[model samples]
Every structure is written in structure tokens, then in C-alpha cells.
Target: MACLIKGVYIAEIDRQENRREDKQIAPTWWEAFHFKCIKVLEDDVDSSIFGAVFEYMGHQIESPKYVIAIRGTMIKSRTAIRDVYMDAKIALNELSHSSRCELALEAVEGIIGSTHHTNVWLAGHSLGASIALQTGRDMAKRGYYLETYLFNPPFLRLPLEKIKCRKIKDGIRFMQSFVKAGVSLVRKKTEEYDPFILLNSWIP
Candidate 1:
């Protein structure tokens, strides 16, 4: 289930990229999920990071939930490689947070400040996952709790002793539990299912 959700966010990122390239105005897959794009966040100062804010309204809900989905490395050129390296540096805390990632988080904070919705979720893939985790940690420090879903996150070499914040440590543990439970559920459900059918149905 975690993998499925991650794939959905990745597909949304691809759709957003295609829309940008073609300059088309079309409904995205999020519409089917009852999510509408509220804001598209981009940083011209640092083009490596980009994200979108979505408002979700499910059938049983009277209020909306907000989601911030960040895009991962494009890897189309040398610049993309540089961006990935920067993400690694940020992960290791060798450098301060990436400007692009910081900008993206600030944008989300701005939206959250103005909105009444209390449920906020964050998601990203690869390098974007690193950014999301870092930003979520910062937000946690600021007393704004956010649930985060990261797919194939980069491994940071920081030791547990180096992390001073107990809240951040707890948050990390929570994310790990959430991911483990999701993987367990997915595996249990697919134990007797055909691999080809699962792949065809899940992969888009």
C-alpha cells in the first residue's frame, strides 16, 4: 500500500511535468482521488526543487485535508546530478538545507497558515523524499505536525547521537513504523496473487 501510494505521487509528478512542458490545462489523476490542485510551488532561484499543494475532499469528510507532494531528481543533465549531490549534503547535514527545499517548505507553511484544515500530509520520492523528511523535521520543531510518506529515501550517515531533538527522532520512528505496516499489509494481500497481474494492475 505504501508503494502504491508512492507510485501515485510519482505519477502525479510526471503529469505535472508533462503539463509544464506542453502548457496544457487538463484535469489530473488527483481529481479522481477527490484532490484538487490548490497551488503549484516552484523556485526559479533554485530549479532543483518543485512541489504542489492539493486539497482533498473525500465522500465521508466535511472538511478538507491538505497534501504537499514534492518531485524528485529529473537526472536529465549535469545540473540534475549536482542537485542530487546537494541533496546528499543536506541529508548528511554537511551543508544547511537546500534553498529549493526550504522554499518549498515555506510555501507549504504559508498555505497552512491561511487554511483551516488541520490535517496535512507530505510526500516525495528519492531526493525529494530527503527534502520532505528534512522539511517535515523542521516543521515538527515549529510545532506544526505533519505526516510524511517517503519513497526510496536517501540514506543519511548521521548517527542517532548526533540528533538532539527527541521529537524528530520519534517522528522518524513513526514514519518507519508506518512504512513497515504498509509493506506487511501489501505482502500479506499479494501472497497468493499472480505476480504479472499485480504488476499490470499496480504499475502505471
Candidate 2:
């Protein structure tokens, strides 16, 4: 799902670079995944698309109903200015107050409220990951826990991995093992049966 989201980002870049809508790759790529591009989200600053919402069309049991994918900072693109500004806001711990965060949060909420028994997923990378993380946290606080996937998310505090102290690293690792075990047990008890098999009707 992360890969698919990234593909949409790449296609958007391609679309902007060539200044042609037909050159976009998202449609073909999404078709392969049995998903349809339902919305292309634009940033308030430049009106350049920075996120996408895909609606699943496949008949796979338990597949997500919608996916909200956000693209990270692009150093050289139409959205570079907005992206860099958002990055700086993140560094300064002002992401929650930013419009980007609000936009993502609204998109996810819309999907959740649009229908009953909906399965929505969220994914983002780098700057986008920060937005996704914030959105997820906000949703959880509101009693809505959506499945979220983050790639290369920024850490506000000093990363533990970069610390030179072995004791701190070892202690963190030990605690992580315990946390993982507890999470595994919880998943086993609450998980629904999902075979992940796709229906033949949707195949090309």
C-alpha cells in the first residue's frame, strides 16, 4: 500500500513536470492494484497536488475501502516551496497548527463518516509521514482508530539510534521486545479472519 501511494506521488510529479494530464501514470498503476483515483488533494499555498485518495474497486475480502496517501517533500518540483515550508514547520513543532495537517485529518475523517463499515488506510513519507502521524494521533484522540502506515517519519526528539551509549540502546531494545510480545497477543485475540484472496471478476 505504501508502494502504491508512492507511485501516485511519482505520477503526480511526472504529470506536473510534463505539464500534461494524459502523461500521468497513476491511473494505469492504480488499475493494476484494483483501485481508482477518486481525489487529488492540493496544497493551499500553491494548489499543487500533494496527496491522493484512492477507492478500492477490487472484490478482495477485507480490503480497505479508501486509502489516503501523502507525498513527502520534493526538493525540485512545483510543490517544493510548500513542501519545504511544511518541513520547517515540522522541525519547529508547529505541524498540528498547519493547514496541511488539517487537510489530511479532514480527508481521513470524511472517508470514515461517508459510510458504515468503512476501512480507510493512511500512508505518507518523510514530511508527509509527519502529517500522517499527527492526523492519526488526532483521530485516535477522537475515538477513531484508522489503520495507518508511515514511511521514514521524522522524529522530533533526538533519535535513539544515533546515540553512542550502548546501554540506552540495549535497554530500549529490551523494552521493545516486551512491547512487541504484548501487541502480538492482542492482535491474535482481536484479529478478524482475512484470507486476502481477490475475486476473479476484477482481474485484468
Give, for candidate 2, the lowest lDDT window spanning 10 residues: 195-204
lDDT of 1: 0.62
lDDT string for model 2 (1-204, tens) is 776667667766776777467766666767788998888777888877778888999999888888888888887757778788999898899999998888888888788878652488888888888887788777665556667788898776547879899999889889888998987777677555211111111110
Which candidate achieves the best TM-score against the true structure?
Answer: 2
> For model 2, what is the error of residue 136's alpha carbon versus the real structure, in angstroms, after optimal superposition?
0.9
Listed per model in order, the count of residue pairs whose N, CA or C atoms clash below 3 Å is 0, 0
Cα shift from native, residue 98, model 2 (Å): 1.1
| lDDT score at residue 143, model 2, on the 0-100 scale | 54
Stretches of model 2 off by over 4 angstroms after superposition = 159-204
Error of 1 at 47 (Å): 3.9
